[model samples]
Target chain A: MNHRIGWLIAGLVLALAGASQFLLNDYYQRVLSVIAINIILAVSLNLTNGISGDFSLGHAAFMAIGAYTSAVLTLPVRMKAIVLPDLPVWLGQLEVPFVFALVLGALLAALIAALVGTPVLRLRGHYLSVATLGLMVIVQVVALNWQPVTRGARGINGLPPFTTPLWAYGAMLLTVGIIWRVVHSPLGRAMIAVREDELGAACRGVRVFRTRLAAFIIGAAFASIAGGLWAHLITAITPASFSFLLTFNVVAMVVIGGMGSISGSVAGAVLLTLLPELLRRVETSLALGGQPLYGLSQVVIALLMLGVMIFRPGGLFGREELPAVLARFQRRRSAQRQAPHPSPSS
Target chain B: MFTPTYLAQQLINALNLGSLYALVAIGLTMVYGILRLINFAHGDMMTLGAYLALAGISALVLPAWAALVLPMLVIALVGVLIERLAYRPLRGAPEVAMLITSLAVSSLIQNGATMLLTAQPRPLRVPSALTQRIAFGDLSIAVMDLGIIALAAVLMVALGVFVKRTTIGIAMRACSENLRAAQLMGVDVNRVIVVAFAISAGLAGAAGVLWSSKFGLVDPFMGFVPGLKAFVAAVIGGIGSIPGAMLGGYLLGFAEVFFVAFAPPELSGYRDAFVFALLLIVLLVRPAGLLGRGEVNRA
Candidate 1:
């Protein structure tokens, strides 16, 4: 229950995650890396979509921006010549270190988010969502057409693979810590208040617009880092990678976990990432009516998600988080111990 | 820089495309007007209709007329079933919950189709006579295009008359106006909502068959882009206004065709970008749309 002990446990979990990569085969290692990146993506999105109630569908657009930024920065000079021959001399000659490139990528994403959020955050609910989706379509179309900067539809390939389990999980922990601190802060409470009742929050003197914008920027920054990690891990970047499907997957993670719960996002991310891989195996091994059910994995996922939405719409943990659940259990036990005794005759 | 004949051809293309967008936008706006939920599954319903037609014709060897009518009827029921199963439970849920549920339903239908029928696009088989080309000076048009335009206009008029003159249609309009009041005033609320969804889906089904036959392809994810574009059309016209949806759809069609036709060859790929930019501009400048009053109806 002590803060130090909690920090120790968190550090230990990160260490274990890092150590497991050594034990895993190449495929499992890749999967673990993906799981960590996805968790980061899910949690960051939860800050805006879950905590602030913004309902943005453009998370992948920011990811795409981040991935492309990091990729362009870290790409080798010679490869840049081949891929983007019309690249500016300054950009073509300059190659930043991977760490700085990742930071720059995230910063750029946050900057864009700030600009977008200023106008977009004013809209409510479905309008905001549609605007964000429009932004995504704009981003994708730009990436598809901006040949000099993005290599257009050809995409960028042959980048260095700098993403490891340690980097991925370490970045995820940093994201989780930042989000946890923000949501628990006074500002975070304001954001949640806005989510609960925007008009009421404004009436109570909460700077509603500012709080929503903060969550959006923070979520965008972390999503950008996840995107950077994903790009580096895959050693290639494409406009196609950051499509609506990516947005859907992250949204699924948020919904399947309690939307506003950080721990729930982690659980949802990890479980959902592993599920499809498991399903793929099952699909290949199992045959029905003498036919190999090739795409059953996605079908099952969609159906299962629907079932969860129908039956457990609040998600597995709902808004009560891991620590909160434990605290409630302790409180209940104490109350039971202090209660007046019942009649023995009864 | 534009030739008269080329301009005329592009205009024809725009009208053809606009008709499809109008059908989709009407469906989207109707459901959104009543339910106040953006039915993301509308596009998937269109895809389902197309696929059903494909099955009826190719697999069951049904007549072409049978293929078209059967799919529209079936998908209308499917739309009602979707409303009953996926949406009815979330009637009072938060906007996000319903939005996400519609998204889930969309993906479920899309992925289920992919699983049952491979993702490979199959060519649709409309009669050659329908697709036959008719020349007008330097501008040639497919009979299919003319048929689609005529069909779309007739359907729109029919829908307008139905909404204005029929008793059930009056109930739907009342429900959309004020749901609780309509319920209190003896409207069969559930039936009205179900009827709205069925009508919307039926229109979407008709659009789907026409779209597939015109394009000569049927695929699971085919509806996704068109669906988003239809949403754009709906938004631009005004979210809940039928006439606004049609106007927006036509504007979008003209914008898309002209942008591609006139822009430099290299910039042609940015056509969608132009559309989205128009959307953002419209959202910022006139959130109510060109035809909409400033009021945005909320559930």
Candidate 2:
């Protein structure tokens, strides 16, 4: 709740991530890293979609930009020439450190978001959603068709696996911290005001468009970083990997976690990420007759999403942080204890 | 390549594609007109229709006409059931909730189909008579293409008459204009919604059959691309206007077919990109679309 405790928790998470390098198996470590990356994505998307009330279905497009950019940058120069001969001469000769490549990728994604958001943010509701979806498809088409730079669907592969649990968790922490700071800032209030009522926010001098553009750009940057981490972790990159399905998964996380709730995003990311793995195990071990339930996880997740939307549309945590929820629970428990037998009728 | 015959052949191709898009887009516009919901699962409905037709023909050994009719009827029922189960509960909820619910429904249908029927593409066989070519000088056209165009035209006219002359159709028009006022005027909102879903799903089913027949394949995910294009068409024609959807569909079909036919061979792969880019341009220039009246923020 306080800065001290927040710093302490952040440090503890990093420590666990470090310990996982030695203590956990490669598979578990990879899963942990993926969880961190998903947290980054879900939380960043929350900034635009939840806090700002802009429903963008193009988060994966930003992620794709980041992944492709970082993958192109961090490949060994010799490998780059072999895999991407059509890349510009300077790009083919250049290779950057993983962190720099990640930052550069994020920057590029943010820049594009700023450009696209200017025209797109004008649309409202489903129109905005469809416009973003269009952006996503356009990105995919370019990635698939740009043979010289993107290898024309072959995708640049055999990249250095630069993503580790440490880097992923660190980026995850940074993303959450930045979003938290934004949510508590004046700019954050302006975003919420704009989301609640655009006309009223304008009347109150919120600069509605600027506030939304800011969130859009910020969300895009983090999504790009998440993409960079994902590409490096997978050690392969393809346009197909960044399809609308990925966006759907992230949206599922944000929705199940609670829109506008940072901690909720984190919780949702962990649950949904692990749910598939758990389901995969269940699917393999348990089957109807002789058939394995290959796509059972997707069915269950979709059903869960539907159930959540119908029953608890606010998601698991609603708009409150974990600490606030726990505090509320504590207060309720003590009050119940104090009034155990006070009165039945009153 | 730029000869009149070549141009005429391309025009026929455009008409074929446009008819398919218009059929799908009409369903989308009709649903949007009444409920203001985008119905993301409509595409999956097409997928289901295609699959159902496949089952009817291949498994049930039904005649071609019977196969087509059965799927339309089944999908219409499925559409009504989906509305009752998934959408009806979230009626007064925020628009986003319904949108997300539709996405969930889409996922359910897609994955459910994948689980039941393998993800592999299945061949959909059309009757030989339908696939036969009808030659007009150098411009040869498939009988299937003619059938699609004719069927689409007939359906559109039938739908036009239904909407204009039928009591339920009038009620639908009233509901689209003002759902609350229609309800206040003693119109059955539930029946109107159900009818909208049924008609949309039935048309989507027909489009799905034509799509599978023309392409000679049926797959669980086959409807996604066409469905998305049809959605773009719906937006272009004004989301809630049936005639607007039809015009948008034809324009998009021409744009796509022409862009692919005329663009450099190297740029042909960017056809989907071109379509989406057009969508962005349209949204920026005319957010309400060509036939759309006023701003789109009804909520």
Candidate 3:
């Protein structure tokens, strides 16, 4: 099929999935929205982590920034007066539409990313990882302590649930489509080259630092966007919501789905999100030594991640997308059918 | 009050915290020095060691000293197992994969602990000698604090000697210097790696006991903040330098304590924020750390 046709089918599928929310119970619908948000997170992270080859543990920090920005921006002025009596006069009086707040929040996160990336993008490997982890902790501490802005961990409440299934799924589709296009673009190829071999990419006249910085900034922006969606979906925002655990979950999705592939990230996000709920149900039903299992889902997630890392380091999809996987399967089937007789080894 | 006695007390507290940080940082640095992967689970191993000790005291009804030593051994074994099972196969994989795996293993252990024993922070009952205060001139100090400091000093010295004298320790140093050259010299690379993990985890286990004893509590997720601080210490000291890790740990301990001690009362809550900001400053200014050789081309 042509690229246009392929994209049309994917778009149709996403629309149907969004529409199917009406068929689901409230709990399932909520779960679906969460899945969509998670997809945004995983795909955005993949830009820096999988494609650009940076190991960051601070994606959630950016999410926190976005969530707070969106929350503070959209919260009713009267409500803000009660919760954040100390907020700046300008910020206190202002209340924008959710879309504008989301965009501004995302922009603020991207701006922070650019500033942070300028200095932080230089460190490599574990150093970069720790630095980003430090960044995340700093953001968390700020959110917990910055009473004037974030209400010192009481968090903003009574947020309107603007993240309906349509909005969430729509954002997810947009993120995936854009990122997919970027990955196939020249700049994305440059990023992949850097991921493959930074020194070689630099030798070939690819601006290693610039490419990485761009990826980091773009990734951070999208993560912030996801964070905004999440804030609206939950109708509340807290610093705790964007902790390292969330970052870890996103990392798990990227790694398990095949880090560099958009489709793989989507699969990982969906599977990981659904797996916990399924396990939560199982936990109540199953008993170990006459005691109900608690935190079984978390243990299982960790073990699954470890298993994936050890056994399938490239992830389930590796570098292949969904279309590629399907095409490969079809080729194998066709090859078998064309053969007069299948070889024993085959 | 910034009186002399108060300052002295803060100094002692800093040193006490620094001792544990040093131990944890050294372990973290050793692993990073050899494998170049930050074992995010190192902190969790510390948690496991503390939990084991807790389990021994309560369930197995072991004596305090016995409880302390047993957990270290168990954690060391666990560390070796982790090296062989989780990390070994990923030797040739990208660094990012290794990092994620470490995180997975960390969460796996922490979540398992939570499942077994819920997230409630349990107060530990220690032998009175460890917690008893001893008067020293104008300063009154816990025997546990002094003991921890002395123990850390002794361990550091012993580690220095071992790395300088023992064949295996030397092999570890050599491997950290150049893995391929060490292999060419007939150094058993895998054995060195395993021993690195074992020794590191053992130190982390010891630090875990010291930390929990100092704090008087144990929980599933206790290792995270301390682990991050230890990483900060490691980074500040020079990631690959053993002495650097120790120095960084003490510096961090002092900085953290003193920042709280001296900073405006309203800003005490931002102490962690300041600590991270310090890390960022250090990374930007001196990426090689205080005594580290030079910044590697991590890209």
Q: Which candidate leads the pack in DockQ?
A: 3
Check candidate 2 and list the clashing pairs.
Answer: none
TM-score of each: 0.95, 0.97, 0.96
lDDT of 2 by residue, A138-222 (tens): 8988999988888868887898988899999999999999999999999999999988899899898888878998999999999
DockQ of each: 0.53, 0.62, 0.69
Better model by DockQ, 1 or 2?
Answer: 2
Candidate with the larger TM-score of 2 and 3: 2
DockQ of 2: 0.62
Candidate 3 per-residue lDDT, tens place, A1-346, comes to 5678768967886777677777887787789889999999999998988889887777899899888988889889999898888999999999999889888988888888777676677766656677778889888999999889998778888887888878888888888888888999999999999989888998999998889988988888889889888988888888787776888889999999998888889999999999988898788788777767888998888999999888888888998889889999997898799885767665
User: Which residues of candidate 2, in runs, are more than 4 Å off?
Assistant: A285-291, A341-346, B297-299
Chain B TM-score against the true chain B, candidate 3: 0.97
Instruction: Judging by TM-score against the true structure, name the best candidate.
Output: 2
Give the poorly placed runs of model 1, Cα more than 4 Å off.
Answer: A287-292, A332-346, B297-299
Model 3 vs. true fold: TM: 0.96
Which candidate should be chosen as best, given lDDT against the real structure? 2
Q: Deviation in angstroms for A169 in model 1?
A: 1.0
